[model samples]
Target: MDAFFASVEQLDHPEYRGKPLAVGGNRERGVVAAASYEARKFGVRSAMPSRLAAQKCPNLIFVPPRFDRYKEISRVIRKIFLEFTDLVEPLSLDEAFLDVTNNHFAFPYATQIAKAIRHRIFLETGLTASAGISYNKFLAKVASDLNKPNGQAVIPPEKAEAFLEKLPIEKFFGIGKVTAEKMKALGIHCGRDLKAYSLVFLTRRFGKSGRHYYDIVRGIHESEVKPDRIRKSLGVENTFEKDLLTSSSVAETLTNKILPEFFRRLQQSQTAGRTLTLKIKYNDFTVHTRSRTFPEAIPPGSMEALALELIRQEELSGPVRLLGISLSNLIRPDDPGRQLRFSY
Candidate 1:
């Protein structure tokens, strides 16, 4: 999908179409969850601070997120994907990977399957989608971004090496901004530069991920398209308009705000966890985290107490700007040995 959340807003509200629009944020606080192409031209982008986004695009319009509506549309899109291929791996509400090697229509070309899927999505949802057709997930993911809005690109196997050699290191799928900077510092500015290093040298420099860097540059990614991807954790966080000045206020927010929302999501997902983590961001923008693991899933009644304990255990370095709680070491209902025991 193209600028998915913002695009959805444009589809439902004609007034927002073809304008600089953002979904989720305000002029005063919060973060931009998505930015329309119009806003992107003015340097507005998702995850940018709302204040900064406003400065970048004076005419940018901000709208609150409607996740339920997005999910509804996402389900419709997924249904279309399933009609073509059962081997579909969803990365998020707006993106997915479809292995069309043996599609329902038996299409000989993956490019044709991609075109058909995008067309079906636009027809059914009144939204535009882009696609990347390639022989592997890495190249496919990279190719997907080459085209914008309603376009598609393909990277055939024979051309993969030459194509990657010229591609910037920053353009690789798994390389983040921080990693790219680190690579650039070491004269690894492009895929060709990275390919010059030996496997042993890369592994030594990048630790376990060095091997990943080495393989991907050579167009070697063995990861399969997992149709059923298990979620590892569930969390919620809130950035405050004013910094929390005291431990008491932090504890109050945990008891009244954070834990309640976390529990609601956990119940909705019908999953439990044996580890509880506390994440804190200070006014200085530094982060700290603490976690406690139990022998069994933490009961609903014990959640508040455990959350409070986690907060009280640490002293505030300064005024706090954000607070979050998460549950990990998940126990889904279908997992083996799924007995719940009280160990706290």
Candidate 2:
């Protein structure tokens, strides 16, 4: 999908087609969920403050998000993907990773499959899409974005390295603003620059993601697109629209805000963890995380303790826009004693 949420709005509203339009964030409290191409021309972008976007383009139209309709379109697009390969791993409601090593339609190539799918999407939903096909996830993700608005790009295995070489490090999916800035400061501005650093060096800087960066620069990624990527660590976090003046006030309110999520998930899993993690997504959306592992595993009943500990830690920091918690290093029910009342 390309410009998915906005495109869906355009498809359903004739007057919105080819007009500067956006979905989500029509209010002071909201952010841009998606921006149409016309909106993009005016410097409007996703995750930007909706108020600022309006200020940037006084004529920009902001439509309220319609998740139900988007979900319906997602289902329709998913069906199109399944026609070619059941090995489809949905990354979000609008995008997916498809393994077409052996496609059902027997399309001559992945480009053909991409074209057919795009065509079917237009025919069925009157919406445009773009696609990228490659031997692995990293290149494929890059390829998908190379062309836009019903376009397709394919990176053969032989050319993968060269293709990635010229790509900007910022365009690497996992590297957000903070990480990109860090890479730039280290004199890594693009794919070629990334490859200059040793794996040990990248790992030393990026922890677990360093290995991934090391392999992807040379187009040597083998990470599979798992259809069943479990909810390994369920958690919630927030990003505030404006800066907070105090930390303790936000800390006092965070549990009331975030603890419900844990309580809700505890209905489904054992909820044990060896670590209590804290993540803060600042006003600028630059995220920083802190974690403390415990000697005793976080019991399923420790949601309160976990929440309080996180709040205390956060109170000592400055204003925070987001708070997050996850029960890591979990042990399944069959191997452990029940410590809390749980549904599953």
Candidate 3:
């Protein structure tokens, strides 16, 4: 789906069509969920503070998020994907990876399937979508975004190298700001530069992620498209609009701000964690994490207790830009080696 939340709002309200609209919470604490291309021109973007977004686009119309409606449309779009193949791995509500190697569709090639899928999406949901088609998951995933708003981009085997060569390292899946900067400093700004390094070197430098970077650079991804993906954790965090500079101010957030999020998710999942982790992300995007294990198992009452206890152990020596707690000691067999993977 293209501009999924904003498109849904526009579909439901004709007045918002082709206008600079934003779909998100309409509060100072809220961030943009999606921004129309019209809004993007003014430096508006997803995750931008709502108040800051308002300053960027003075006339930007904010549409409150309709999660229920978005979920319904997501189901509709996923249904269309299943029509072609069962090998569909949904990435959030708007994006998915479809494997058509042994597909039932009559389409002669991946590009044709992409075009048809885009057409079906627009016809069914009354919205546009962009698609990427390639021989492997890595290339295909990147191809999908090359074109946007009812467009398709296919990276045939011949063009795959050239396509990835010029692509920025950040554009690759799972690579974020911190890793991108690290890679850039190492003279790796794109796939071509990354290819010059050996897997052992990348692995030594970046741990497990180096292996992925090594293979993806050569267009040799072998990851499977999962269907019954179980969520292992449910969490929420806070990024203060202004810096939290004092211990008292930080303590207030653990009790008054962060603990509620853990409790809410704990209640919803009927699960709790014995290990608690505290994540403090600075304005520069640098992060410090601390975790601790407890003897008592997690219960509904213990969720907030664990968060507060974790907060108590933490030393807020400087200003905090973000504060987060995670209850991740979920004991599920499907998740392997998790018992030893305590975050705190």
lDDT per model vs. reference: 0.91, 0.79, 0.80
Q: By descending lDDT, how would the candidates be arranged?
A: 1, 3, 2
Error of 1 at 332 (Å): 3.1
User: Highest lDDT among the candidates is held by which one?
Assistant: 1
Please say which candidate is ahead in TM-score: 2 or 3.
3
lDDT of 1 by residue, 54-159 (tens): 9989999999999999999999999999999999999999999888898999899998888999999999999999999888899999999999879999999899
lDDT score at residue 219, model 2, on the 0-100 scale = 86
- Which parts of model 3 have CA positions greater than 4 angstroms off? 25-30, 106-108, 238-274, 278-290, 294-297, 315-324, 333-344
State the number of backbone clashes in model 2: 0
Instruction: Report the alpha-carbon TM-score of model 1 versus the true structure.
Output: 0.95
Pairs of residues clashing in candidate 1: none
Spell out the clash pairs found in candidate 3: 132-144, 291-344
Q: Which segments of candidate 1 are over 4 A away from where they belong? A: 340-344
State how far residue 48 of model 1 sits from its true place (Å): 1.3
Ranking by TM-score: 1, 3, 2
